[model samples]
Target: MFVDSFSRWMKLYGMRRKSDTLAFVQKFLADMSGTGVPRSFWMDNGGEFVSRDFIAFCDNAGIRRTYTAPGTPQQNGPAESAIWRVNKAGHAARLEAPRLFPKIDFTRVPGFGRDGERLWRESCHWAAGGFNRSPTKANVGRGTCV
Candidate 1:
């Protein structure tokens, strides 16, 4: 997942391929077409992020690309925190599975709620909402919406 430090907005992904990363950025921009492009895009020193095609795309889009120092995740604390919180939630969800779905046999059914999708979506929303409620300096200069 890629999280915006100031806004606490996140883009979750199932894979981390270079093409997938680029496609995610493109889709996000298309989805928020009129909001204006971000001034810069930050990421870790991952192969997918450093791909030549991705760099070209960002350049063409007029977005500056920034990479965090190797082995220094603290340089991107917001994203790290967001990932931690979501992983913690996932652990809690897994531990609560037996108690919450006692009637369902995991050996056969292997699903939560109506289906697996609902549980995943609910967990994501829960994490994102919690992140959004966290204190941040980004909104201080933006306006009252913070």
Candidate 2:
């Protein structure tokens, strides 16, 4: 499973840096499919999780998609825990490298634009490479499947 956090920043003049919600989902599925299709997925009811594109992808993949009820994150205990861990790690990384924050150009990220347009293909490439190698607590000593 893949997990990550989405952040939104408000701006006064130009378009706001709205969170890139679909990026995570698309990346997650692509990475998982590289190995094999999963039987199902459990997620929260966030806009990203419930998007039409995500639903269609799951349908085409023959993967069952389950959503937790509103305000009841406990229903998706594992996914919630994974998200919390990722958020904590991201926060720590930011603290360690303060300058890295300014380098992230949201407009350049892939699977992030409207209507399935890809912008940040490079970022997606890097993330996929690293994420597929990172060990996970869920898998214990077993490495992640690419």
Candidate 3:
């Protein structure tokens, strides 16, 4: 998943493969609502982002790519923190599902059954709601305007 710092919007992918990353980026660019193509992209030094194909794609799109220093993920702190919060929301949703919807028979959801699909859907809603309702810090002085 990738997070936009200013808008706090996220684009999530089901797969972790490089091809999936490419597809996500393509979709993000095409589907962006308010903002146009970003001036630059900041990411960790992952093979998926550094691959030849990805590099060419970014070059063609005219998007500057900046990578965090190896082993220093803090340089991409906002994205990292967003990832953690998203995952935590998933965990919290899974734990709360049975209690909140006791009659749903979560064990029979099919496919990735046993609450898998339901949990994922619920988690996404919960995370988005939480993010929207949360107050943004008033830090115009520091340029943290989300």
Clashes of 1: 0
41, model 2: CA deviation in Å? 1.5
Query: Compared to the true structure, candidate 3 yields what TM-score?
Result: 0.79
Higher TM-score: candidate 2 or 3? 3
Instruction: Report, for every candidate in turn, its global Cα lDDT versus the true structure.
Output: 0.70, 0.51, 0.74
Candidate 3's C-alpha runs over 4 A off are 115-122, 132-135, 138-146
Q: What is the lDDT of residue 140 in candidate 2?
A: 58
Question: Across residues 26-132, which tens digit of lDDT does each residue of candidate 2 receive?
Answer: 55556546556667777777787677887887898798988888999888775566445444544444343324555755345454343223323333333444444
Local accuracy of candidate 1 as per-residue lDDT tens digits, 7-45: 776655555456587888788788667767888877798
- What is the C-alpha lDDT profile of model 3 across 1-146, one tens digit per residue? 66777756666555646658888888878877466888789999898899998999999988999999999989998799887887888877776777788888777766436656545655765675566456566323233222
* Backbone clash pairs in model 3 (N, Cα, C under 3 Å; residues 3+ apart or in different chains), count: 0
Q: How do the candidates rank by lDDT, highest first?
A: 3, 1, 2
Highest lDDT scorer: 3
Clashing pairs for model 3 are: none
Greater lDDT among 1 and 2 belongs to 1
CA displacement after TM-score superposition, residue 12 of candidate 1 (Å): 1.6
Task: Determine which window of 10 residues in candidate 3 has minimal summed lDDT.
Answer: 137-146
